[model samples]
Target: MYSFKSRIRYSEVNERKTLDLSSVINYFQDCSTFHSEDTGNGIDYLTSQNRVWLLNSWQIIVYRYPVLFETIKVSTNPYSFKSMFGYRNFMIQDENDAVCVVADSKWIYLNSDTLRPVRVAESDIASYGLGEKIPMDYKQGNIILPEQRVSKEPFPVVPANIDTNHHVNNGQYIKMAENYLPDQFSIRQMRAEYRSAATLGDVIYPEVALTDTSCTVCLASENKKPYAIIEFIS
Candidate 1:
């Protein structure tokens, strides 16, 4: 496991002065990226080899949101690698050593040039050996969507949404989905399934479904094919 200590920044918190769910997701994302870089298999190497690891899905549970300026520790562990798929677990712990947030993620290793799944190399596994899986009620497969939903206005993907991969950043999707959430909805758990990449100039038509306990948002193309599906459970 790779671990790092940090203090909650004012920019990372919500109006309540507590860390928001989207920022929590960003921490995990950054931790994993740091893990890759420290392991000598980072973006530069991936790009050199014409390879990229695309996020497949995410399952994050927030036990409590840390307040601004609170000291915390963020960590990530790569627990499994099967063929083209890689699994990882991430956590954020308070100064007291209590876990405040935990996440499970799936990734697909692909040939960047072809954008097709490929087997992970032996060198890749050797650098980042698998660790024990984190304890959680692991939910596999796609987040189930409700049959009925309402469509929102379509928006164009701007450069700000693009990352080094030249596509929408994984966390940005969650940020987008959060806008459709009901006010004051305290999210305890969130899950997302990434179906395809959305690049600059692409328009996203958001479809939202809501219930007393949950909200589901599908960010899709004009044809109604989903780019990603995000679910939040309060």
Candidate 2:
């Protein structure tokens, strides 16, 4: 596993001074990116070869939210790869070595020139040992939204929402959904599936369905086709 230590910065905390869901997801993303770079298959190298990795889905479970300024360790490893898909797991532990967050993610290798999926070369990632899954009961699954639900005003895709890929970053989708959640609930787990890319000037219509213990948010286009689905369990 690739590991790195960091402190929860003030900017990463919520109003309650606790680490926010987007920050947790950022930690996982950074750790995996570092691992890829360390293994000689990082963004710079891949892009030079006309390739890039795109996140397909994520399932994150949070047991505890570290407070601002708390020290934590983030780690990740590629556990499996087949065809164009790669499966990885991530973990965040407090200073006491207690695991606070666990997540599993799926990513796809893409040919930048054609913007299409391509097979991941086994030798490119074989160094990170495979076949071991994270010890968590949470599984990645489809998130279904009811036909009728609360629809919020469409959010314009601003300049800040665009990332290096020229599309709305994955974490931004989670943050947009979080805004629609009731203030009474505290997020304990989140599962998001990326169905399409939303770029600059594209407005997203967010719709939500809430339950006693969980909530589902779908960010879609004007025609109602979804770009991302986020399920939050309180």
Candidate 3:
């Protein structure tokens, strides 16, 4: 498992001094910075060399929440890695080893130069081994296609949502989904599938479907064209 110590920041906690959902997700991501080198070369350097790692999905479960000013340990290990795609598991815990959060992830190997998926080599796989292997069985959420949902409200894409690629940034989807989720659901996990890209000045109609335990949300263009997808788990 990959591990590091933590110092919970005030900005990351809520009124209860506990971590917020977005902050939880962000810190969880920070725990898994998987660049090719520890020699000060960053992700951009690896991607610039045409060896990018694409994240496909994640299933995070939260138990005890971490509070501001608390010291914790964060760690992760490769889950099930094979071929073009790999999987991993992660956790955040107190010094006593009491887990505060858990996350399972699916990742894909991308040829930076070709922009295509590629198989992982055995030697490359060996570098990530942490120790024990969990069961190969992993929980995966099906990517809800954009066309599947029925519309509720229509909104235009604005300049604020646009990012470097001139497309609606991925985090914008979280903002949009936040509006549709129930107040009771703490939103422990979010699994999203990127189907189409949304650019600035585009209008999108968001659609949602609700179930007892889960909710499916999506943002699409006019005539029911799809832009983004989100699935919420309790």
Among these predictions, the greatest TM-score belongs to: 1
Clash pairs, model 1 backbone = none
Worst 10 residues of 3 by lDDT: 33-42
lDDT of 3 by residue, 1-234 (tens): 677888889998877888776676666566666423442334665556566566666566777788889998887777666788877777788989888887777777777666688888765566555445433334655775534556787888899888544567555766777788876776766677655668878888888887777778877888777676778877
TM-scores for all predictions = 0.98, 0.96, 0.76
Please give the RMSD of candidate 2 to the true structure: 1.2
> lDDT scores for all predictions?
0.93, 0.90, 0.70
Q: Work out how many backbone clashes candidate 2 has.
A: 0
* Per-candidate clashes, comma-separated: 0, 0, 1
Once fitted onto the true fold, the runs of candidate 2 whose alpha carbons sit more than 4 angstroms away are none
Give me the displacement of residue 30 in model 3, in angstroms: 1.4
Assess candidate 2 and give its TM-score to the true structure: 0.96
Candidate with better TM-score, 2 vs 3: 2
